[model samples]
Target: MFKNRYLYIFLHIIMWLGYTALPVLNAIQRDTSKPQTNPYTNPYYWAYVSFSSILLFYLHSEYLFPKVYKQKPIRYFILLILVIAILLVGRYSARINFVGNDINQTLFYINSFIQYLYIFGISASYSFFTDYQKQQSTKRDNEHERLKSELSFLRSQISPHFMFNLLNSLVALNRKKSNLVEPVLLKMSDLLRYMLYEKDDKQISLDNEVKYLQNYIDLQKLRFGDYVDIDFNVKVPTFSKNIEPMLLIPFVENAFKHGVGMIEKPIIRVELQTIENQLLFIVTNKFSNDVQEIKDGASGIGLTNVKRRLELLYPEQHSLKVQQKDNFYTTELKLNLRQVA
Candidate 1:
């Protein structure tokens, strides 16, 4: 609310104007007056009360509230008593000029004290509420920036692993002087271009992501040839949905990395489809019990990295499960396709 300067000021003016005009409204509404007329009806008394209320409100809000309420509670109580005494005495003095000596001073002073306290309390509460709101907004902004930085770092980790795998494929082709080298290098160029550009976006069309994956698979096929059997199937909506970039490739990469080496008749299968505005993807690879996971500093950002990205980007909108059973390693993911704010 405080973010808009003009609106906040206008609201403040409207509220105080209504409060200041209340006595005049009451005076106009009265059909008759008592034989001993009340001081509240007098324009002078009304003007004096309005000034006092406004003064008390601003004084506490601008000056005393921060120091007293935030820093020293005991001092606030003591200073509050002084404030009440001073304002009460001033109000009583102003009343005498209009009301004369006939009124009870003690009762008037007590009532004046209560009214001044009411204004002070309102001012303090308003200030505190605004400050609290600003603090919470700051915390949320900080958290958002923190998450953004972490996500960028995770994406960076993916780049080297991807480049390393593609480079290895190119190396194998170049060493053998294969005719497919040029085409594979061209495919790698497309993949590299997409990684260099599209990976930075918060969201990209699912079609683009699918194309990227196809390019990666083509490179892998060009490298492995008849030695490995790989199948990739995709069914998606005609109207493309949005998805986080670099989200689906790591699992398929893992399949290609481990499923082919020294294993008999190696096979890797990957399938993706959208049903009822939800994405379902599964990657399965046949693995020999003897084939072990290779660990290195330049290795692919594995399941843990992808899992964390899923938690951050999709939260409750996604589910992931990984299993090794009956000599097959399987990773399945279900993700909501709805847009998020």
Candidate 2:
């Protein structure tokens, strides 16, 4: 409520000034044939009224309005009428008894009621507006926190899925006693370090993301060696840009996960190109009809996670297309880099 302290203070000053000046101005405008008995001349009367008004304003605003009215409106209205009546009676009785003034009882009651009404209206309106704004702010904060948690869970899914596949490759190399095991472990170490440390950031240098993808591709190359045909190409201009970490790797991993083993003469093609403030990523692979679709467990979870992340993070800034025709599965992603965070 006090986010803009100066504005809050300014508005409060203006309200109080108006509250103090209006009744005095009205008294000056009225016919005062008996100048000696003019109520405006009595500073004590004005002080009592001002103090009582401020007290009632805060009572209704800070306590009664929200806790009582919002929960039980009928009860609140009943209590408000009772409070107003008591205050009016008290003020009229005090004025007649203590002041020793011949003031009209009915007129005093009417004027007192009107003044308290004005105070109640002003305080209630201000309280309601500020409360509504606070509720909206709280709602936005909760949504932001939920998004962060969901993104964390999705990224968590990707790391373990990638690691499980790499570990499987390592096991295969160990059984075959392949000489490329050392290099594969080195590449895996770099990939793991990058994922563990750098992936926590909302954005990473486009250069680093490309290098991570290259490391994964090289590891896959060692795993397959001469058995499968692979074509990986990246063409990025000498420019500086940031991309969501691990955003593009799912498509490449999906290609390798479902595009080999069961298939004869398997082929995987991954290409990335950047033109100005736009990026294009395409991954295509050949699959065997005998193999199940990549919609089970780890494969399905990875794809779903990335798709949701893209929707949340990029929304209108990116487009994705996945198509399977005959034995080939292809995924094409286009992203607008201008809105990168």
Top model number, lDDT: 2
Q: lDDT at 161 for candidate 1? A: 75
User: Model 2 Cα displacement at 273 (Å)?
Assistant: 3.6
Clash pairs for candidate 1: none
Query: lDDT (CA) for every model shown?
Result: 0.83, 0.84
Give candidate 1 regions above 4 Å deviation: 1-31, 34-36, 67-82, 175-177, 339-341
Candidate 2 per-residue lDDT over residues 1-110, each given as its tens digit: 57789897798789877887677667766756653365654566666677678878888888789889999999989988888887787677667654656877788888
TM-score of 1: 0.86
Stretch of 10 with least lDDT, candidate 1? 27-36
Local lDDT at 236 for model 1: 78
Q: How well is each residue in 228-309 modelled by candidate 1, as lDDT tens digits?
A: 8889999876436888888999899889878987899999999999996799999999999886777787565666688889
Residue pairs with colliding backbones in model 2 are: none
